[model samples]
Target: MKRAQHFIGVAVAAAAVIGVTSLVGNDYYLRIIFMMCVYYLCAAGMNVLVGFAGQKSLGQAGLFAAGAYAVALLTTKTEISPWLALIAAAAISGVCGVLIALPSLRVKGPYLAMVTLAFGIVVEKLVGEWTEVFGGAQGIYGIRPITWNDQPLTSQQWVWFAVVLCALAHLLLRNLLQGRFGRALLSLQADEIASASVGVRVYRAKVIAFVVAAVTCGIAGALVAQQNQYINSDFITFHLSIFILLLVLFGGAGSMYGPLIGAVILTAVDAALARWPSAQHFLYGFLLLFALYVMPGGVAGVFRALFKERTETEAGEKSEEPPKTTRIGPAGEGELLAVEGVTKAYGGVKPAQNVSFRLQRGHIHALIGPNGAGKSTMINMLTGVVKPTSGSIRFLGQEIAGKPAHLICSMGMGRTFQNLRLFSDLSVLDNVMLGRHTRMRNGFFSSLMGLPVAGRQEAVTRGRALELLELVGLAHLAHQPAGSLPYGLQRRAELARALATEPQLLLLDEPAAGLNPHETAELGQQLLRIGRCGVSILMVEHHMDLVMSVSDHVIVLDYGIKIAEGKPAEVQCNPRVIEAYLGVDDEDDIEARETCPPSEGRRDAET
Candidate 1:
């Protein structure tokens, strides 16, 4: 049903573009439409970065210039076809994208923005000062126009070319943004720590987004070279990149129509302000400010609001039945993880000291401690989110100490944060698919192209994620924004996401922290089901009822040291654990002490 709506929306948009292009009666209007398409291409690329991946790259002008220069140089210096030149431009831009991505993505926020800004400046200067090749600001002229049927393309042919190119770009981006790759990028944007925990290589996702956006802008630049039959260094400017960004943002960064709407509206605005040439730049700046203030989500957001069809998420539609939960399989049995003498110390402050534990397959082990006892830190060490100051950690017989979190995840360990870390902007289904990142076999190219194998893999992944969601009773809300779910449900969703990794060992940090009694009971059942499947469970939780009920083995921690390790009942009765952790004194009265009461009262009576 949703896919059908997507196709319907695309058809409507394409028909609208075709209809508008057909109705343009003169060369002047034809040229306007052509320019609009060019800008549309640039805006769409920017959207992939800023909208989908949440990367703020202000150097797209540099990428655009690279593309134009590649096209211009290839066509003028050799007999290469313009189509081939465009592909070359894309490749060139992609290389440049990697260069920028490696250094810039290392830093974030304004620092990252400055890196891209500096890159644009550098590109502008290289073309201007490197006189030998770039023709020194005069740029390359008389570049071959796109020839159709062995002749110069007519104005109508040019328009059709623009339409086709824009349509193809739209189709490609649309498919990607709705697939596993897009989900990975979106997950990266939401929370890097959580993303890594779910097996997304944070750096790789960023680089892919950066390259895709750059290639899109480069393609647009090639179109510009073909349309004008000339290129100038001055044609690519920092201001041009800024305008393209504004166009994308003003239209709606993440939406399919965002770039087109922004391009069309801003193109018309530019034409309207042409007569007031001196004030045009100022007018554009003013308009950008206005749009940011009044319509922060852009024109697409406005359209959605007006039609009351604004999307929260594609997956979160109303469902008739409650979500179901799945039973874990027996394929995950045996000794899954072992930690020996693991210690993590910060500035001589020890959070974990010689914490040694082994998790046998299919057992639910509970790590319980009070605040500052380092339960969370221990979990982080196990997942490789934190490197143990000293010790050996092994998972499935592999040394995993200091391994990257994503690599550890790929080794079949899945975890949930003590604080819920979910991708708020994505659907519940997307969050679960994120857990399947390591499981996915399709690469960016295959996924974008929707190849048969990619489709089959995606179906398998989606089916698995849905089944996991059902186990947590969230299948009904699979399409809902994960953040929009209730606190208890978010915990369920988090569990489902971790389970989606198909982990032989699952580490849950406070899985039942915010659930009601009933929910907590259900969660225990869920954990038991997961355990029965042969998946080992290690959880740090404050809920004793939950911990005692679900856990097969219980370990007590006090001030970063293990105080007791035994069966849940034995650990509960251990005096050292009661004194150091449970805050219980032996002599406390039965009525007050039997169910565990105030420590102060017992001390007062004894004193």
Candidate 2:
């Protein structure tokens, strides 16, 4: 494959550089190369956290210190092998990463950054003031360096080792980032709520990202300390954290090669500014601002903009195929969901109060209500987006009230948002593929190592996603950005994504709100088809025509209370429903109801 060949070429080039540098490059140049590798290792993991997972951390210097100090103490205070000490250092840093991730679970944005900043400051103080163990500002010395064949490496050999490590890091990260794990991180960055609805464990993903960043940065710090045979608080500063961030921002954040580019460019610039410390700080600040405001995508983004990457299209596939009619869910003949005494109140403002409902397996039920009614609130509660104040919601005969959203999704429930929460920047196929997150069986390590199982799983998920796109009439736009599609197409794309979850129950919120008559008709057909595929649907829609056409049963709510429930015709003739919609006087209501037929009432309510 072209991707395999590209990786091979990169490896060959790296090996050649290593061999050439060992023979001809001086110690100074080798040292520069060594620093670049270290920074690259740091930035590669940070990219996952900052660029993909969208967690902005400013305490990476603390994690670096954890590794550097760990190696320093393990080598100096004990008789442990330097290599084992390096592993220990990484473990320590990983633990610290988990601790740092705790704050992220509870906070976000600047608050999270401030928490990380405080962590870095605390680590700095501990290293500088804990004189007996850390050597205070004077630092630890005489730490054992890593060895090869029981011999300490030469300066050139150190660079060679770093380069090999960098190469391996690149390959491993590429394997991890291009698969389900990578997509999960990206989905987290796009929208955590949507990500959770699609079965991504949002908090768990955040912790994993932080641990990754911590481990790699820890490894880099250990390498630096071992190579130098010394380490101090000076190695772990706020400025160093900023510099590590700059490496990602300046080179490119999300791209795999961005960290390498950033490490190379920023390391060289740092070396160039070694003579003027104040100017270096000022310049770094300016560059950070510039990178943030002027070139948000960095050098790699500039290249993408200039060259415009080739479109990802399936060759020789010009016409779209009809959607597959395969069974979408397990065939069943019992109640799928039951909501009893569900109530949600916000201190005197109750969106839903003592509501009860039942949805049969493979049936399409419609929840119709005007604006300010409790339709959306019911959907939110059912999907675990909002916990009920008091209720029992049972799905598949198990109580599910107040559970996490991701857990609810994993239990074979999928949903689309009323306001549209697609991962807009991702390709339509990817957005749909994300719906299969809970179904993929490969673990983090398998994906990280690019195991055959991971590849097969990804391929299968991709195929299924494409099929879903075809079903929704968006196959031609599968490779296009989801956000670029028209509103109606986006709605269909969302439907495709939800279907990719292969849910036993599908909850759609206002699926026809913005569609034209034809599109709504198509949607109605799709719903009917989905129902025939054995997937139960609970749709909250205002378009009465679509509801009447596709839904087997209808429930009406007005002012947070259920006003009527029955077949379309029966509900249409309910006096309570008529009074709720028309607000006619008693005499007028009686006279109008006597004259107006049920179909006319339905038409008038729609008007």
Q: Write the per-residue lDDT of candidate 2 for residues 373-461, one digit (tens) a residue.
A: 89999999999999999989999999999999999999999999999999998999899999999999999999988889998999999
lDDT of 1 by residue, 317-377 (tens): 4346654535543464577788899898999899989988888877899998778889999
CA lDDT for candidate 2: 0.89
- The TM-score obtained by model 1 is 0.90
List lDDT for all candidates, in order: 0.83, 0.89
lDDT winner among the candidates?
2
Evaluate residue 264 in candidate 2 and report its C-alpha lDDT on the 0 to 100 scale.
92
Error of 2 at 345 (Å): 0.5
- Each candidate's clash count: 9, 0
Q: How many pairs in model 1 have backbone atoms within 3 A of each other, for residues 3 or more apart or on separate chains, i.e. clashes?
A: 9
The RMSD (Cα, Å) of candidate 1 is 4.4
